[model samples]
Target: MNTLLLIEDDHRLANMVSEYLQQSGFTVQHAANGLDGLKVLQSTAPALVLLDLMLPDIDGLEVCKRIRALPGALAQTPVLMLTAKGDPMDRIVGLELGADDYLPKPFEPRELLARIRAVLRRHAPGEATEATHQTLKFGSLELDRDARSVSVRGDVCDLTAYQFDLLWVLAERAGRVLSRDQIMEAVRGRELEAFDRSIDVHMGRIRAAIEEDAKAPKRILTVRGVGYVFAKQQD
Candidate 1:
């Protein structure tokens, strides 16, 4: 069973979510504030964190930044953020902060469970045996699918699990312009919602990690009003 640390300040909501996730086969741990959440995360090292954006103490974004600053595997742990704010900017900020996925509040329990499972699957090891011996290369950037690792110019790029998958999907089809819908479907097994900018946010994050100059990216090019393409010629 996967363990989950839920950082939420609302007692009633936390209990409800905890019970629901527990029934879904997760060992759920709860923290009412960001400080306690960080402590629980370090001590328990849960498989995934369900972070609420509005914590009584430090905000969720700060917590996420701290998590990403941790050493080793802990830094790359998947995060699924929950927020009552449905603003696209908030969602984008959360994704930019290294959240694997984001779920706006007023969500169904089933949707939350689905998001949790999807995030976990992206981070799960031992599922890449089929591609164990294969590595994809684009210029100096190397992606080991089996190892779930990426490096540019022999230097490792710190990418969250979801970011790596997004990069893989793009690199695998280098030079092809992929619409937001197509990319989302291929990577997340889902369609893009109207006005959803999560994919754009993730793409920005990916470029920041792998591109030589994020402002004038040469690896991933924006087609403006269409989507994006990974340049075929990296030289």
Candidate 2:
């Protein structure tokens, strides 16, 4: 079972969420404050983190920053911010700072569950199936498995860990259309419940790094109603 670390101050809310998620097949651990949540995360690395923005000791944004700074812990863990702050600016800031998804309070249980599954799907590791590719290439783009680096036209592009992983998955199966869920499974190695935009945004960043014209991308093509595909050849 996938372990989840939840940081929320409201006991009633925590209990409710813990019970519901447990019933949905996750092992949930609850912390009432940011500090306590951080401690628990340090000791036990959960598959995903559900963080409430209104923590008592520290704000959830600060907690997220601190976690990103931690040595080797949560560096790649997907964080979903749960808050009542529904402003557009708040969501943008959270995403910019690496929060995978934001769920406002008063959300439906079904929506929350979907978001959780999306996040987990994005972060879960790739399967150890015999069909998985060890390396993938497209035109001048290359994803080096041993180095975990992305190279375009033989020049290395500075990519974040998540960015590289996303590109690597897309490039490895060039021309193949992959749904958001399929891409998430290949890249994240788990399941994601809600933050599917992370994949799109990260793909945009990767294209900006490689494409000659990001505004009119030629290599990474978006299929309407479908997911995304890395074009084997430029249009």
Candidate 3:
């Protein structure tokens, strides 16, 4: 059973969510606040985290940052953020903070379950659809599919599980400019919200990690009104 950690201060909601997830064949660990959630994370090592933006201690954004700072594989643990319904800013910020996905509050249990499964699938190692070759090289930059790691000149680049998948999609199709919808379809297969900028945010994070100069990126180039393309050659 895949264990999951839920960090929500509301006991009633947490109980309901935990019960629902338990019925869905998941082991649920509930934490009421950010600090407790971090502690539970270290002890439980859940497959994913369901983080609530509003916490009694540090907000979910801070917790997300802290999680990304953790050592080793733990730092790449999938994060599914929960934000207030209709609060697009919080959801965008959550994604910018390295969340794999976000489900706005007061969401249907089924949708939550679907989102969780989707994020987990994207982070799963060595899926059959993965390229036969385990690694790809672009000049000094390297992407190791088996390790789910990216490095430039032997220096590891920090990226969230989602960002890694996003980068993988672009790197695998180097020299091709892909629209936002195409990229999303290849990665998570989620419907883009009207005026949604989540993909752009993830791309910004990816560029920050891999590009020598994010503001004047040479590896990943924006097509202005179109989308983005990973440069075929890099140094």
State residue 23's C-alpha deviation in candidate 3, in Å.
1.0
Q: How close is candidate 3 to the true structure, as a TM-score?
A: 0.92
lDDT of 3 by residue, 1-235 (tens): 3999999999999999999999999999999999999999998899999999999989999999999888877888899999998888888888877898898879899889988898898788875345575888999999988778899999999887778888999999999999887887787646543335688888999999888889999998999998999998757
Best by lDDT: 3
Candidate 3, 214: how far from true, in Å?
0.4
lDDT of 1 at 20: 97
Q: How much is the lDDT of residue 118 in candidate 2?
A: 71
Top-TM-score candidate index: 1
Comparison by lDDT, 1 against 3, better one: 3
Report backbone clashes per prediction.
0, 23, 0
Q: Deviation in angstroms for 182 in model 2?
A: 13
lDDT of 3 at 184: 78
lDDT of 1: 0.86
User: What's the lDDT for all of these models?
Assistant: 0.86, 0.76, 0.88
Work out candidate 3's RMSD over C-alphas: 2.3
Point out where model 3 deviates above 4 Å: 127-131, 188-196
Residues 3-103 of candidate 1: C-alpha lDDT, one tens digit per residue: 99999999999999999999989999999999999999999999999999988889999999999998877888789999876476777888898898899
Task: Estimate, for each residue in 116-144, the C-alpha lDDT of model 2 and write its tens digit.
Answer: 88767655555544565466666677776
Off by over 4 Å in 1: 127-132, 191-195
Q: Which stretches of candidate 2 lie over 4 Å from their true place?
A: 128-131, 138-141, 144-235
**Candidate 1, residue 116: CA error in Å?**
0.3
- Of the pair 1 and 2, which is ahead by lDDT? 1
